[model samples]
Target: MTRMRADLLLLLAAFIWGTAFIAQKYANDSMGPLSFVGARFLLSWIALAPLALYERGKAGCASLGKSDLGLAALIGFCLFAGAGLQQIGLVTTTATNGGFLTALYVILVPLIVWAITGARPRRIVLLAGVVSIFGAWLLAENGHLQKWTSGDALILIADIAWAAAISLVPIFLARCDRPYFLAFAQYGVVAFLGLVGGLGLESFSGEGLAAALPAILYAGLFSGGIAYTLQIVAQKYTPAAEAALIMSLESVFAALSGALLLSERLTPLALLGCGLILAGAILVEAEPALRSARMVVRRRRR
Candidate 1:
């Protein structure tokens, strides 16, 4: 039941994230990417502040030491890098493209865990990586190697950072059980960094902000605050690989959102690419159960 609830929460997060892609894309028309990210995350921080304070009070802050603070900052930096890159990438890429490319992080998460912890990844994960790589190439390369744009490169970098962030979450959850407090720290850090970058690198008017306000609110409240918090809570119960496999559905939801809301269309080849990525995720999710069933059959035969 706990795992089932976790899965449902993850699905909800995916839905919110998928829909937010359209909001993010629309915001870019009115503001610089960094500025949009800054404004959106600031709103998230604000929305989460009261809840975070309440959680900290209930849980007590004694367990949150200097090392905990440091880890929170690290996660926050990763969040900023990943999200900032994606926001910038969305400027030149379609929302559908951004959604699918970002999902590549699902394949990369196990590798990130292996690299960080020095534990070997499962063979199944490695195989999935190979398949996912081909799918990415098909999605990004427009029949020519030279056709890949700056946007694709940016989102690819974002995928790496996002993978690292996802792998690190369970580690942080182990140390600090206060998920709301951690959310506050990460969101606050991203907001601060984004604001500095926006002020230094981009200029925008109040009118532009007003125009982007609805999208900003949706992204901030639903995607950044609610969905992300739900993910942290869900991860406490679910294993990272399974969680990632389920969350990868965000790509499908994003594609659907792009079509329904933004009228974006994918080519037949691109749809095929989406299928491959989804197939890889499904394979990864089933690998453990398949291995168990195979072991049972072999033992019976012996």
Candidate 2:
């Protein structure tokens, strides 16, 4: 695919993920957090099975190597943990708070990448991180610094987990031959974990299942299946930094959707926060200005 097409797909994935916050909010109203996550992934795994079969043929059923399996399982655990925490947080937090907190993963990813690879982050990235955090604070605290809540704390932790999972992807994908297989494996592991947790704590009821069914289908098919596939494909064509920047738009999209669909009002402070978040994202991702400055410096040196 063209770079532009890949970029668009990644953006679409962000949009789908953003809108999913609302669906999840509705689903949580009627189901236990573990139960909801388990059901979503279970349905997602089943939905993606045919695609996996097509990619690997009948041999797709074969088990992964020990190392590959372990890595995949680890990734699955991270996924499960992050989503599980976010789901639990949603029980107490507003959807707006959840969205902003989750977007912190974007800022965290660069810092984690720097730590793991021993690479220094650019000035723009540092500025972006500061701006994004300020935006998050504004959105979550409504311009107050002293009003943070427990749900916000949980979501922040989940964001760290998400950043770790995302950073680990390039490493594993570089080493593994079958990205699709690895993806499916992670889904299976998470689904199992979700189901196990759900069984122990949740009271299953027909009405509850019915209420969460739409969210399950939406998250499974669009967010889980299509969005994930797009990420894999787009990451292949785009730089990790660029992909991360595009995906960070999830926060902006989520806030907009919340205001539009859920009648969540966007106060002036919230709008300013969104602008700061966008400014941070641009600072982190844009390279043209840096290149121009470099060219001017080289000309002056000559």
Candidate 3:
């Protein structure tokens, strides 16, 4: 694909994922969070199964090795935890809040790396973390600590889980070359765990399932499968830095969708908080490029 086409594809993917936050919220109107997660991931797995088989056939592998399987399982567990918490958070919080708060995961990544490796984050990363956290407090508190809801707490935990999951990706990818099979394994594990959680914690009704079917299919097929496929293809053409910038627009789309489609409104303070969060995330993404540009300018002066 040309760079233009790839960029468009990524933009589309971001739109899909952004709208998916609303789909998740709508799904919660009828069924439990775990059930929604279970059904959607199972559907996503089924949709991707054919592609996984095709890729494996090309590689001439009948099954993944045990190490790959174990790694996928661990990654899947992290995915499940993050997704489950986000879904539950959507139950009480507006899609707007969920979107912006979840974006905090970008800020959390460096902090997570620091915690895991005992390496100190740079000044920019630390500043971003402080800014993002203050933004979150503003968004979640809405003027009073008493107004803070369970959903805010759940989403915060989900953000941490997402950060950890993303940090694990490089390690996992280094160990396993088959991205498609690894995705299949991850989805399968998430489906299995979600199903178990749903069965143990929530009751399923056919009527409720029917009501949630559209949301589930949209999230699973379009958001999970198609958007992810587009991202994989687009990343081949686009630079990682540019792609990250484009994908970060997902938060903006989510907030817009929430406002336009769901009539969700944020107070002025909350809007300011959202803006700060977006600024912090953008700084995190742009800092490396800025530093590199500065170094080149210094060399030119010399």
Best by lDDT: 1
Candidate 2 lDDT score at position 129: 73
Each model's Cα RMSD: 3.3, 3.6, 4.3
Give candidate 3's whole-model lDDT. 0.73
TM-score, prediction 1: 0.86
| Residue 152 local lDDT, model 1 | 78
Compared with the true structure, what per-residue lDDT tens digits does model 2 show for residues 215-240? 99998888887887677667666655
What C-alpha lDDT does candidate 1 achieve relative to the native structure? Answer: 0.80
Q: How far in Å is the alpha carbon of 226 misplaced in model 3? A: 3.8
Write candidate 3's Cα lDDT for 1-302 as tens digits: 58778778877988898889778888998899999899998998898899888887785554557876776788788889999999988888754466557766766666666676676667776676667556655654352444447897898899787777655555555565566666676678878988899989998999999999999999989886777556655656654334544565576567667778878787788677667656765665577668889999999999
What's the distance in Å from true for residue 19, model 3? 1.5
State residue 26's C-alpha deviation in candidate 3, in Å.
1.8
* Candidate models: Cα lDDT each: 0.80, 0.76, 0.73
Clashing pairs in 3: none
Worst 10 residues of 1 by lDDT: 139-148
